[model samples]
Target: MPVISYELPDRFVAGAVGQPGERAFYLQARSGRRVTSVALEKFQVTLLAERLEELLDEVRRRGGDDAPVPAATPSELLDDEPLDQPVEEEFRVGTMALAWDPEGEQVVIEAQEATEGESAEPEVGDDDPAIAVLRVRITAAQARAFAERALKVVAAGRPPCPLCGNPLDTAGHVCPRQNGYLG
Candidate 1:
């Protein structure tokens, strides 16, 4: 009946209110058009669930001569929908990249091993091995936070390149990379 959608800031499903010593109603969102019903504490969950259930029942009863049956059961009230994809967490160290995938809903952590101190050869000898990959699943909330943090980091701007800490300006500088130093 009542559908609850939670994104960034808030996370909650719609439910019904109850009188003193009475059971309240709750609706957990399943899909775009369906919500399952459950009982909850009054004044805590929203009343929308009860309202939608009443409306749906009324419509069903009007269409059919027999009593309208509920389409779902209380056990199915909780959401079983597939969760959103996780966001990638990347750290840039010099030219190397370390990354991991994290699930926001649960506490999970993964790390990428350092690739330094290795020979230039790509071949893996008996002792040396390739680096392992890290994968994580993060909730929508986690994704949003990650994006926000990246934006802030970019806004702060990066330290001058170690090769040239000073401004290049239009004159440019004399470096092996360049033809000549115009300064």
Candidate 2:
């Protein structure tokens, strides 16, 4: 089975290769010794950042700054490692789950592969060929940094179509809003 490490990540960020729709996004987390990378769609990265911000707001509203998260700027927290080499994916993530751990004051991110359908029984232990889950624990400060950097990476891609909200290409895009005509 493939190994999924459970530890506090010192560096965590969502990065992509290519442009917009053609982009291949990856969720990467690195500790002192280990680096874990998982392939996911660009939309997944966007949604994760959005949901994490909402969770953080809710926590702050309910708890009233009890933990007092340290101030961390995005530049100070970015992962410096090149995503090109020595970063083989553990799995292609199919489902994602995120939660805030109140007791630990940490954000927990989990990504899992698509499982068998309801009609199929799940395999166990040696019967299962690969580990399908990746989980990482990160601080709230790190969460903010991650969110900021993720948005920058996403926005650096192609501009969006004003009418349909889909990314527009340099050559142009056929927007559905305009009845499938290039706008």
Candidate 3:
């Protein structure tokens, strides 16, 4: 397995390319010049962001006021930059994991490459060479910023229909609430 690990990377962000309704989502991590980009579904990005927030909240609740976790992302930590140029995808992420490093006081995220017939759980310490993983360790502040950006990226897609709550297409769509009429 090839693991690309970044400990306190210079920058890490979730971004999308293409138009709103036809966008492709990616997670990019960078340290100096080395960069890694992995593609994943929009829903996966949403779940990752929500889970990160929940994890941080739990950490804050347990650790009280002394916890390194912040209730909200710091303004300086907010990242709104587009993805780095030449957004070459290294792999399509199938599974992801998150953990809190208490001693290091950082959030750990691992996105593993999708492969057919692979086990649901990651193979710890395995050197299969076929599996590729992107692991990043970032401060709680950075994690909060990442989640905020990811949610925004996901929400930046097509606007929802007023009646049915489904995404409205550029050419309009068959709205269920309108009895399948194109609205």
Question: What overall lDDT goes with each candidate model?
Answer: 0.30, 0.74, 0.92
lDDT of 1: 0.30
**Number of the top candidate by TM-score?**
3
Give the winner by lDDT: 2 or 3: 3
Best by lDDT: 3
Error of 1 at 46 (Å): 41
Model 1 C-alpha lDDT per residue in residues 20-45, reported as the tens digit of each score: 22423332223443332333333222
Report residue 72 deviation for candidate 1 (angstroms). Answer: 33
Per-prediction TM-score to the true structure, in the order listed: 0.22, 0.82, 0.93
* Residue 83, candidate 2: alpha-carbon lDDT: 60
RMSD of each: 23.3, 4.1, 1.8
**Candidates arranged by TM-score, highest first:** 3, 2, 1
How much is the lDDT of residue 117 in candidate 1?
Answer: 64
